[model samples]
Target: MASQPADVDPAEFNSLNEDFYRADPAETIEHRLWMLAAFLADESTNVGGQEELSLSRDEAPYRKDRVQFAALESTLILHQAAETLLRLCLAHWTDAPCPWFEMAKLRQPRVFPKKVAHVSNTLDTDETISELLRIVSWSGDQDVIEAGVKWGYENGWERHREGLRELIRYCCVVIRDGADLYNAGKHGLAILPSEKGVSIGEGDVISVRGPSLTVIERQVQDGDLRWAKVTHWVKYKESIAITGKIASAVRSLWECGKTAGLVVAT
Candidate 1:
């Protein structure tokens, strides 16, 4: 490869030269999904070398940092697995053009659809979840994906669809419970110190004074304030259970999808 001239505009040149968007083969995508599934299954060290059953900090034998990191990572991985599976379903099962929001992210030759671009420029998790629920809802009318699965897999998708619904419900609970804790890890976990700083978790109500306590100091710590500890965060055992459910769901869905994909391929 020849080195570019020092005077050339690097950003523009790189943009022009890069193959930003390439549609991966369905087989490759399937393989990636399986890899994620495997990661979820190997839960040997969810909270710092301790198993998921070790819920309380006392039994975990690990610092809070490690515990927090594992919890946050597992939550994120579960969400990603579900999102990717849904996207694959949309791509393979539906004939509708790719959502403009997704298209904008890809580096392709196709022009963006301006009219729908504004409305569909982002991958809405809620929308995807809703669509997935609808597909498996057992409604009288069959969606494209359902029809394809029935035609190709001969009812293989039926059980998987039921499993998916259960997994979806579990994920929703995990997301709600873990959202604040996960966000706190990314930002900083706000620790409120009081002489009575007993046990606390998410959603434990308390009182707050003017200008929330951002800073802590001996001199400024003069106020009778009360606030609730947020307890929505999932513990070790719960995290493990959630990941296990996700792994099972993704595995089942992938197997069924792959079989159906091959049938259609033939």
Candidate 2:
């Protein structure tokens, strides 16, 4: 950023920011409205050096976007105006997380807005481009944002990739990758006791026999034997069809057990 005029003091900035934060939302936004006016007062803050941008006009698209993305009240609307448009969002300028990204960390949904709540965290310099890609925000240009996030994550923002991935998932980016690993074939699979009987952890594959439905639940127990959680497991689409086959298998087990004089639960 270019240096401010010598007359423009920096010491008052903290007080200005504090007052801005404490002001009623309207007053806070009014202050930003004035800042926009000031930013556009210079011809440089516009599409061309010949024209000064008009917030009332040019800013309307971004304002609408912010309203949808953050659900900003009338008072806090200026913050979004200043951050997304007044700052680095210009096509010719460098893009970076705004300084207030830290402020968003200390504030509430009101400050950061709930829709893009993922970006409210304090973003460090080390945060990779990939990490930023995972943040969920409403850009009218979803495709552009998605590409930016993906590029951000894969490039310098490695640490933030998971977070951005989570945001992308939250936004329903489609075709998530990790749902097929745990499945039970036939009687479907159930979390049953291992031959040795230790609890299974995530990603451990265990064989379950006679499961009317393959249940990928937390390990449970029946008498001395452990069973997987019966009520809360995800049923795989393809393998779930085996439930009927397992039911027939169970009936055969019941008949054979009874013929052998073995007791069976109802």
Candidate 3:
């Protein structure tokens, strides 16, 4: 009798291949952006509900840390979605071979600026390249383009050079700022720092988690009698707004791209 191999589940394995790695590039980008947006929106809702809960009744200090961590995670998601969208836009609209690769290398911000700048040269002749560069500058101003070019090897025209520069700026802010915070959080800076620490007082509730503590204090003067303790809680409302903005911006960009006939043929 032939024994059935436990690890060989043909039906399950086939189902995984159906949509996991077979999505068309264009559709995949769009779908991923929407999926990230939905996740961020859910996080926003959770944070809001948590805030309301805190307001209605006394929430354990740990609740604040959990809500803030969720917000930070949402920020990280928004940043990733923004960068992916930029690369996708270039791939869809640019004439350069390997547009996505060029865009990724160009936006490195630390290394390969020179390499990225030369990417524009791959588009067309100097005249078309110049025009494309001009058009892609966040502002249509020559000085702005020149400044961008001077600041880094970024010629700003990776994709045959047609894009919504204003929208690009909006998206960049979210991605860049969120990236800094996200990196910091990932590297053991998850707890936001405060100038003053909460002092444990009689009858005051204190809940401490790993790197996260509940503290409520405005400022501590020298020689204060109360003991100062650090907290891991963070204010999440601002983060929530930023994530929502990023999601909205991506949706708007997608709509604009569709109107401009940037869909991939099935």
Candidate 4:
């Protein structure tokens, strides 16, 4: 039903289609990473105190709302970037044809390592995390490594797999722990700026005072009821840390892709 335009030759169009099929995977991954870097840069500029703000009492609420909006959007962008990194990692490990589309159906972080495991018998989720951490050479930074170790110690993660697991759990995985807010933002738009607190006595209370956010989800058994589940405490510092980790991982992947391409060329 479609015909080539008079000005365009059929042979040239067919050659273009062939070129598409023969496109370089490494170059494709680089382009995706470049776009992701642009998104991250934009998010950073908006949330990194670069924007002017009024300190007047009358404009306090407006300033607070603007900060909350930036936090929410930045969190979403970081999560999406993590997923993109996971997909790129899978593609690099598998070296499969049309991997972008082939792995498009996999949306869960847990499943990504499992898919990689299929390609390699010994590389499980933890090993995959370790590989990524090693590639990034995060151990060279004393401050970063110490922070990861401190977090792992506080959270009861094993010393053997502490730093590796921490990176995967915090910056990479997005199913259970760091996922509810992202899912809520994407699906129901049920995130709200709130405080996390607990009642102690009739008139007393213990509260974790901070600028935080909560995600509300519909009750599974009772669809009519909405459950205010406190998911993330929305720390901008933590978001920035996670973004840095993702950026490091992306850079490592770019280098690895280039090395792999060179190997194949020889």
What are the Cα lDDT values of the candidates? 0.40, 0.30, 0.43, 0.52
The lDDT, on a scale of 0 to 1, for candidate 3 is 0.43
**In candidate 2, what residue range of length 10 has the lowest lDDT sum?**
172-181
Q: Which stretches of candidate 4 lie over 4 Å from their true place?
A: 1-61, 94-98, 105-165, 195-205, 218-231, 262-266
- Candidate 1 per-residue lDDT over residues 197-258, each given as its tens digit: 32345664653322111222222224745444543233434544555555554454444433
> Which is the leading candidate under TM-score?
4
Better of 3 and 4 by lDDT: 4
Candidate numbers, best lDDT first, in rank order? 4, 3, 1, 2
Clashes of each: 17, 16, 1, 0
How does residue 39 of candidate 2 score in lDDT?
41
Write down the lDDT that model 4 would get. 0.52
Q: Whose lDDT is greatest here?
A: 4
Output the lDDT of residue 136, model 3.
36
Score residue 262 of candidate 4 by CA lDDT.
22
